[model samples]
Target: GFKIGGAEVSRKHAGFIVNTGHATARDVLDLIAHVKRVVKAKLGVELETEIRVIGDL
Candidate 1:
């Protein structure tokens, strides 16, 4: 339940991370990476995404 780069892993939905402010691409990426790392390490699940990344952070 931590926030990374101003993005949060939704408590209601593990699949979504919402930007709480003026978060850029890098912010979301950093949050996603952190989330993946933590989730994989703690839960033994690998996260794969089809989400597209656009613009520079």
Candidate 2:
């Protein structure tokens, strides 16, 4: 678990995955969806992404 803006942001070990190299906006969006699904299924909490996804996927 890691902290961000006084909130516990993630549980699956932060800094494990990153958008360091050539990560487009769509790539980040996909990653966010995948993470939400995984956390929802495992933790039974519906996680809401803080960022707004614009445009089509």
Candidate 3:
């Protein structure tokens, strides 16, 4: 599992990022961005988010 702040990419599921504790919206968003970047860089694939983010980013 990869952790950034209180957000983590679940060890059991690569596609799921969960809040360990006290995770803010920014933390989740940052982690998502990180995953996208890594996937693109390593696998030459572009990932698109299935969820829509609302509110200030």
Candidate 4:
């Protein structure tokens, strides 16, 4: 699921690497970052993660 401009997004073509539960924000963020880097390098298109990261350092 994703939201844009404060509205729920219903598009299906977007790529999302979701956390499979029991994952901390840090874990998800790290995975998202890695995906962005890899996808950009391999496909030449920049992908953004839709999750918001918050809480503790």
Per-model TM-score on C-alpha atoms: 0.75, 0.61, 0.94, 0.53
lDDT of 2 by residue, 24-47 (tens): 666666666666777899999887
lDDT of 4 at 20: 46
Assess candidate 2 and give its TM-score to the true structure. Answer: 0.61
Per-residue error (Å), model 1, residue 23: 1.1
C-alpha RMSD of each candidate structure in angstroms = 1.8, 7.8, 0.7, 8.3
Q: lDDT for every model?
A: 0.81, 0.59, 0.93, 0.55
- Measured by C-alpha RMSD in angstroms, how accurate is candidate 4? 8.3
Better of 1 and 4 by lDDT: 1
Name the runs in model 4 displaced over 4 angstroms: 1-14, 18-21, 54-56
Q: Best candidate per TM-score, number?
A: 3
Cα lDDT for residue 36, candidate 1:
84
- Tens-place lDDT digits, model 3, residues 1-57: 888899999999999999998888999999999999999999999999988998886
Q: Model 2, which residues run further than 4 Å from truth?
A: 1-17
> What ranges in model 3 sit over 4 Å off?
none
- By summed lDDT, the worst window of 10 consecutive residues in model 1 runs over 48-57
Number of clashing residue pairs, candidate 4: 0
Query: Which residue pairs collide, candidate 4?
Result: none
Clashing pairs in 1: none
Model 1 C-alpha lDDT per residue in residues 3-55, reported as the tens digit of each score: 87778878889888888887667777888898889889999999897698766
Report how far residue 7 has shifted in candidate 2, in Å.
21
